[model samples]
Target: MSFKEASKQRGLYLATVARNLRLSPHFVRLTVQGEDLERLPRHGYDQWFRLCLPTGDGPVDLNALPDQFGLAGYLKFKSSGLAQRVAVRNYTVRQHRPEVGEVDIDFVAHGDRGVAGPWAQRAQVGDQLALIDQGRGFSPAGESDFQLLVGDESAQPAILGILRDLPRAAQGLALIEVPEAADAQPVEAPEGFEVRWIDRSQSPARPGQAALAELRGLSLPDPPAVSAYLAGEQALVTGGRRHLVAAGWPKSKIEFVGYWRAGGAT
Candidate 1:
């Protein structure tokens, strides 16, 4: 299904933080667990959700949250006065273990910047939050010879999740950009898939520039037989899409999302 169609089917799940780990200098992983998570669907590739995080020391009003974050639901949430106390943001599921009722989410924590990132950095066991599953974004509906995945640090979890869940025989190339080389994580991609990590710290370019440059330099297969997923910074998403389209790729074969804009709160 398309991302919008997938988002229409939703349910609110309340979970408590079980563990917090600093995976890298800029990455923090939060594992949340609850009985509600048992009902969460395993959509695999780039599965995301709207996360409701408490902004104050006060207890969160879980009942105030909507089952889905559509326009009507967002209006209801804002009218409930919960918007002022809760920060809602979209995040990708890094891992989910239904047997143990746990979901892992990775945040790009850069000190006290951003609502969810800082919250995750200081999140403790028992800290509460709510999630509304919006399903997966990467859907290879048509026949494709190979896949092309590209993103920056913010989209790392999603890209990695896609790689992990891809078929063992799938062949593709993933260009992932990160702030530092240390932020690169180990991937278990198919033998035919090449996962390239672009370290931004090694160059003076912006967050997604290095990856975009790499993308522009690649000799891609026939556009009609290639499925591409581009995400991360706003510039990268739009720029990558434009580049792909100009290179003879059909718009239908490319899936893109701007996870966040540079110089803006995520």
Candidate 2:
């Protein structure tokens, strides 16, 4: 489903931290559990949600959260005083196990920097939170046969999830940028897909710059037969979209989202 349609979905799923693992120098994997998770839809590719984390010491009033975070709901949530106590962020599902009522989310840990990252780094087992499913965003054109995925660390989980769920015969190229080579994670992409890991530690450019550079130099398939997904840093998403469009990619075949900006909080 499109993100817009997903936003209309109504429900609040409360969960507790089940497991937290340091996947890499910059990545943390958190597994959360809730009986309500079994009822959450599994759309697979790039499935995301609004995570409501209690940041205040006061008792959490998860009931104050709106069913869907539309404009009206957001205003209601803000006026409820819940917004001040809760830190909400959008995150992608790394994996979901309905049988166990658990979902895994990956966070880019930067040593106490940013809201969700620090919280995730120190999150203890049984910690409480709420999630409002926002569904998947990767929708390839029906006639497209080739896929091009580009993103930095912030979009790693989403891009990897998309790669994993792609058809076995899918042909594509994924350009992923990380702080260091060690930050790269193993991905289960189709045999025909090529995954390129760009290390930012070796360069002086910003987070998504290297990936965008690689994207610019690559020789891609016919634009009409290709589906491109660009995300992560704002410049990369907008710049990549502009480049792809200028290179003849059909606007309808490209799906992009700026997960975060380089100089600002997500």
Candidate 3:
């Protein structure tokens, strides 16, 4: 949890799937709606939450969610046999339209191997879901000369959201890796901000490999200060940070996060 604990705007919100759309062969967009979402705080950049969904064909009581937020609260609920019937996962808030009381979540559908991916693949409009707001991770103090963003598939939504919120005068570079070329989408960015999309459609390497390889080969600007945001597989985040530091970037300027592990990609 790279998120700030004190910054969490905790709340148990009930959301029903309003629609599901496939953005690519590996991306599914789910629109969830509820009046409770109207009250959800907008932290913008990399805002995420913990989702509670029905698990393993078992009956679930949406109201059975833990009364508290954080690890202890989740563990308490899990100890009571709720873990079997409840599926928990953390997801980024891709879009939040408070006026419509709707939040859009983009899921990386890798296949039927994982709980969340399968659920998103076949989710219906009326399917019920629960979530606890955990707030965001990207909070810069506006001191950097430029920014650097790098991530694999899982971090796409977060990186995209960050790009959306950046000022028009911002200058930076964003490297986003996807499983296939079809997964790449047009992203809005400042004129000086280079958004590079790395396609690993023919690579035998796993997710995050392409991004890491690209970062190693990239030539960064000679700026006074740079803010780097690295996310996705553990290796990618750590490896990317190491590469940056070796290239003269300050350790304090980089925000590295392992959003998921390669072993769990299936």
Candidate 4:
């Protein structure tokens, strides 16, 4: 591989800024574009990146640069630096069009009440964030004839990434849990695969009451490999894994992740 390609293979500290867009009632889209794109590491399916923002920066304007280096420039404002940590949770790269050097991250906009959500709520074109992390690429799909993907809003980005990476012939089910009827939207997936969404958050993540139910009742096809990936609320994820394994999935063929735990997970 060329040096340029090799450099793009590793995560770099993006000292740059990008524009933002409100995507849905619960999601905000941050579009970061700069020369730093030349160094963005290629990561796994559903990988996340660290977005370090200052707690003091006020509202931002999309049409103009914030008279300095954007949020990155806020460091000089108070104590010569801003509060930093790997605080913001992991988010999926919804679209990575390297050809144009633009990547999109959809942040769950929880009515500007969340730390990250509110930050994204007022994000603008001149807003700068120190992106210092990138997840390893999505888990390798099984060489089997089919696959299964499960998750809720938090896990949707990763699930969607995997689906878009699948071959046209891959077959399986992708069961997702969103908020209400309005949150449900058409998604592109392999034609052979079935996509189902359940509105469970109208109340709360019910520990797999809906997903585990549907997954347990399904008839899985036999193939060289049958992989199942379950992500979302912690309790629900655990139950899904147990149910899948009990249904005959080998431990090696299943991947379960707790994207979030109920009862005030930070």
Off by over 4 Å in 3: 1-9, 56-59, 141-144, 222-224
Q: What does candidate 4's lDDT look like per residue over 30-147, in tens digits?
A: 8877666555666646655545554553633222212233244334333332333223345566777666567787776655344666777787676666554445334656445468
Q: Comparing candidate 1 with candidate 3, which one achieves the higher lDDT?
A: 1
What lDDT would each prediction earn against the true structure?
Answer: 0.89, 0.89, 0.84, 0.63
Error of 3 at 48 (Å): 0.6
- Looking at model 4, the pairs that clash are 26-109, 43-137, 44-136, 44-137, 44-138, 45-137, 45-138, 71-128, 144-225
lDDT string for model 1 (78-174, tens) is 9998988899999998999998899999999967878888899999999999998888889853434689999999999999998888888788899
Across 214-238, the per-residue lDDT of candidate 3 in tens digits comes to 9898788764467789999899999
Q: Is candidate 2 or candidate 4 better by TM-score?
A: 2
Candidate 2 segments whose C-alpha is farther than 4 A from its true place: none
Kindly report which residue stretches of model 1 are placed more than 4 angstroms away from their true locations once superposed: 141-144
**Which residue pairs show backbone clashes in model 1?**
none
TM-score of 2: 0.96
Tell me the alpha-carbon RMSD of every candidate. 1.3, 1.4, 2.2, 7.2
Angstrom error of the Cα, residue 131, model 1: value is: 0.4
Give one clash count per candidate, in the order shown: 0, 0, 0, 9
